[model samples]
Target: MTFSRGAVEEIAAALAASGLILRGGFSFGDDQVAPAGPSGAPAKSVLLVGQAGAAPWPHFQRWLGQQARDIANPLDTWSREVIGAVAQGRGARAVSPSDRPYLPFQQWAMRAEGLKPSPLGILMHPTYGLWHAYRGALLFEDEIPLPDAHVAIHLCDICVEKPCLKSCPVDAYSGQGFAHEACLGHVRGPRGEPCRSGGCLDRNACPFGTDYRYPPEVQAFHMAAFARL
Candidate 1:
């Protein structure tokens, strides 16, 4: 099925109220299979939905305030509720990065947005940098007419100093892959006050996309969640 530009715009407008953005989209190819939808049929296309920086923080905080204090994975819950509504209204299926089967969101993101991984293992955007995330995706059984994918310069390639690899207090990202335990220990310890209250020093050190960096409160929320996990 053909999706008109107006259709895409309408979807964008619906998500904007909740501070979500339509990151990008692509149709499934033979080499890359489409995920199965609720009907057990393969979805023909997918439109990625996400937030840049702290765009969804206010909406999320308001939602959190209204919820039970002990709710688990509140962010994921909010994403599902919001994106699921859009999918229902648009006759599509909603899927998330944290779904049971674990869809290839990272690979799909690379294809859709022409992004590459940074030293921090986050997909580095040319403009948004590391302050963005893929919350969910809208899956349609019909092939949608999406804009042509354009190549973007990998910001990490041009980054000479690679400060993100060196700024962590624990040297968590010491090039041998993330020192997960060491990073976790530091974030939970008394000495981790800076990162716990602010954000990951390594992530914050990246000079790119300074304008889009998340505020301290938002970073604190994410840091707290990471510590819990």
Candidate 2:
């Protein structure tokens, strides 16, 4: 359940060299209490997170339309590599923070895992908005220490505008929860102003993390997924 900091850094370096970009939210504290949000399991001893992305939007765009069925190969590649390295000797599962059977992800991550939800949304960041998604989560037989836990947050309770809710052309999201069907219909078939005018206005409207924007083709592939739903 423990390893030297240098060992951790080595893993990070190896993954980075392999193409997976490291997101800085490492935690090494031993807070017996397991994380309850996301997948709601405190049984894990370590947490590792990495995102999948492509360098040029154009290359990504072609991948989406060409042989790459599930485009975003580069990011997915990073995700698989890092997760594989981390799970070198363990069993792992890839999970999305969407409609789940157990407790809501926000509650569990915040309450059990000691993970704090971003003010924007439980799993979403004001910067990444909804465009980005957690490619997959790696669960270890025991806890793994992280570099830091600066998941600094802002509370949405005081925000007057609540732009995330109102921004959705089809009103797919609300204080209650996300309406996937409503969102997908609009994005795939063009039912509302934002979906009709551009694409997913709710995600695009966010003003944070502009540098890590999702490519257009990736967006299109996502839209296709929505349509099938």
Candidate 3:
């Protein structure tokens, strides 16, 4: 069935109520986003979905165990399964962040929401802060009208203190760009206890959206994943 923006939004809201937020999206003619489709068929548009703060973790944790088999990357696995099911149910195709020839979700997000990056390189959401994440996106053959993207006031621009810079133990993020190796090294070291068991100190230090911070256990899960890779 052909879906209108309102109908798609209803789907988005339903998903959001279950823990995933339809972050935003874009519409393109078939020729524009060609060759990226899972079946190699052109998609008319894509809607981005994500997790904000601790909202999705509880839902995800509960869903994780019911899986019939164990998987290495449970988060990615679950995201694809759930989002794909939803999209398929609605006659759309589901895509993931890990999809080959990766979709530039960050750029898509910026276009979708006119968002700018934080000092730590994470997108500084006006409301969700640095605590949110893009899980996956849905591609549709049916056309949906695009929403107007407006630039929000970048929270980092006005913040003079910039505590995210100083809060990190290893000084991993700065004007020099993310010292990925340095971060991994520190997370593996004894002094990385707080970060290893909790989460990135710099990310947690962002004052704009403290209320939306991921739970320690959730943060620890992601940190552990980063440490392993």
- Top model number, lDDT: 1
Q: What is the TM-score of candidate 3? A: 0.92
Ranking by TM-score: 1, 3, 2
lDDT for each residue of candidate 3 in 1-229, tens digit (9 for 90 to 100): 6777678777787687559988888777535644345456687677889987888787788888787655688999888877877776676778888988888888888988889999888888898889888888887766677767889789999999988999987899999999999999999998999998889998888789888998889989999989999
Pairs clashing within candidate 3:
none
TM-score of each: 0.97, 0.61, 0.92
TM-score, predicted candidate 1 vs. hidden true structure? 0.97
Q: Candidate 2: what lDDT?
A: 0.48
Using lDDT as the yardstick, the better of models 2 and 3 is 3
Candidate 3 residues lying further than 4 Å off, grouped into runs, are 29-35, 68-70
Better of 1 and 3 by TM-score: 1
Location of the lowest summed lDDT over 10 successive residues in candidate 3: 29-38
Q: Write the per-residue lDDT of candidate 2 for residues 54-167, one digit (tens) a residue.
A: 333443334436545554435445355445665463433333344255323344343322344433353454454344444344444444555334443443434466665667
Clash tally, candidates in order: 0, 20, 0
lDDT tens per residue, model 1, 1-229:
4678888999999999999999899998868677886577988888999999889989999999999999999999999999999887576899999999899999889989989899889999999999899999999887788887787888999889999988887899976999999999999999999999999999999999989999998899899999998
The lDDT of each candidate is 0.91, 0.48, 0.83
Q: How many clashing residue pairs are found in candidate 3?
A: 0
Better of 1 and 2 by TM-score: 1
